[model samples]
Target: MDDLDLPTAAPATIEEFRDRLTEITDGLPRRLRQCADHIAANIDRIAVSTVAELAAGADVPPSAVMRFCQILGYSGFSEMQKLFREAYAPGFPDYSTRLKNLKDGGAGSPSALLAEFIEAGRLSLEALAKSADETALAQAVSVLAGADMVHVIGLRRAFPVATYLAYVFEKMSVPAMLHDGVGKLDRRHALRAGDAVLAITFAPYSEETIALAQDARDRGLPVVALTDRPTSPL
Candidate 1:
């Protein structure tokens, strides 16, 4: 929003665009920061959304949206939109269309749905295997194994993973605690010296888990995070 110089060339890919956005969004003025946060969180909508629609979502004026685009090294909103369109507009079916097709093909049946879920899980595990860092993983295992206690915290979609981890640790005779945060309870005070943290989260990460993990790290505990991607804020 300031009258700072900006580059003319747009980011060539969505990943670059996102990295740039993450790098610059916090330094922007209030209105432009609003635009950046909205755009980052709703990137898939940009290809089809109008300037007015995006502005409303950001709770800023259309002029502010245009200025935000310029700040991101685009000529304007249209140029930014073109970038997203080029990235996501090629033969990608929307979820509604996919669901409709599944229903029509009787793929909504229980067995078919189970098979779909199994295949999806397999693909996710395969990707995880391909991307895992053995050295970092080994370091994490060493930290957990050496710790007096391991504090596990994950909520929402990540809760099951945390619970299973706790169960596994218990069965293996490891000292571990799972922070479920039931009834708005705060269990962060239980974190003690000689403890380590295992934080599990994905996109739209659990704030409670992050806060607790940060608390542990601030107290000099080693934190080994399990997240979806490198850019994830764990």
Candidate 2:
């Protein structure tokens, strides 16, 4: 049922590349490090720009870029470009471009809306499948399962997830509570030494979530953060 014969390779997907980049990029030589940082920040340009254009923007020689590609298991600049293109793919529009398109009627019909939703969900799943670390997940499960209680907090967009997790935890008889700011209550009062916390937020991280996370840490609770980026405040 599986491809038992597939050859092992370095960074098979954009998500894998990113995971490996975080762990290994810092130790790379100066030339490769520059190239890596440039591409990380300018992902939108990778799918459409030429090697020379990218190299110029990265301020490194084209050969150095090629060398970096080789380090990631690509055959050459073209091969590396193929991998680079995957992350911002299909149309490769920047966030502003996508926002503008939405405002300017990119999905003017039900069919267009459905297709857009499908594509977005598919990409999100693809990223999660490729990027989520199994060990981290296992560790989280161990901690939460062993905790006397789990304090789950998610504000605004993440509120639904928080509420649902709290429900499920209670159903599983894992003493837990959702910090929903009900009655203007200070949620930290609910935490105890044996309790743990799980906070969820995304970019432009919510101040409330950040404060809660900080408080949980200050109270010596095991805290887990669910957010969009590694640099998330939560």
Candidate 3:
């Protein structure tokens, strides 16, 4: 049988690599998902085992193992292994443990933590106020108010936000669809020009959710994107 028929292999491509990483870390918290992506992208430069080995070590499945390799643009697990073997090195300052170091200086005190959180919120509000155009918001709200169908899509960390938006829209007597999964999406129904989409995403955005947004936009739906960063691809 050819290599394509092999039980323990996967396609090599950047898309594949990203998909695999996402699948392997599907249910993880946002922080853990970021950590997984960071590790997968740098796997070539880090001392790691085979795709299977690494997946097992990372407590993920073999498919997720090969998917991680594919996301990095390798042909398959073998090619990823070769690159990893050639460039493998390791170093770190135990960054997670360093959070404990802050407590030594009273940085972990409740008052200090509260101050940091408040500052973060202030910075976020300031950035949003500076970057978001009032005209765009008004236009989007107008489109939403008049659309025959409004779809809200979000994944992982952003899913809760989408749900809340859907609930609010429902209370306002708007026909809103909240797509948190494949089963929730009714793509068979034709989405026309008057339809509106609200897509919420954050850094390390979910590929599926992004694709859904693109598909809606292609179908002539007006898309209003809510993202943590202005430069986010939606």
Reference-based lDDT, residue 78, model 3: 77
Question: Could you give candidate 3's per-residue lDDT for residues 1-234 as a string of tens digits?
Answer: 321232244533333433455455545444435436555544332334455556655667767656544544456567855543442222121222334455566555789877755654665455346435677689988988889989888889998999999999999899988877866655625556778888898878877678878888778778888874323576
* 195-216 per-residue lDDT for model 2 (tens digits): 8888998655678888988998
Each model's TM-score? 0.64, 0.62, 0.48
Candidate 1 residue spans exceeding 4 A from truth: 1-4, 89-91, 94-150, 164-177, 182-196, 200-207, 222-234
1-234, model 1: which lDDT tens digit per residue? 344458556687766787678777767788988888788767767888899999999999999999988877888889989987776554244343445666778565799888865655665455356435677789999999999999988899999999999999999999999988899899888888999999999778888889988888799989989876444677
Q: Show model 3 residue runs off by greater than 4 Å.
A: 1-107, 182-193, 228-231
**Against the unseen true structure, what C-alpha lDDT does each candidate score?**
0.81, 0.74, 0.62
Best-performing candidate as measured by TM-score? 1
lDDT of 3 at 8: 49
Clashing pairs in 1: none
* Candidates arranged by TM-score, highest first: 1, 2, 3
* C-alpha positional error of residue 95 in candidate 3 after TM-score superposition, expressed in Å: 18
Question: lDDT of model 2 at residue 55?
Answer: 86
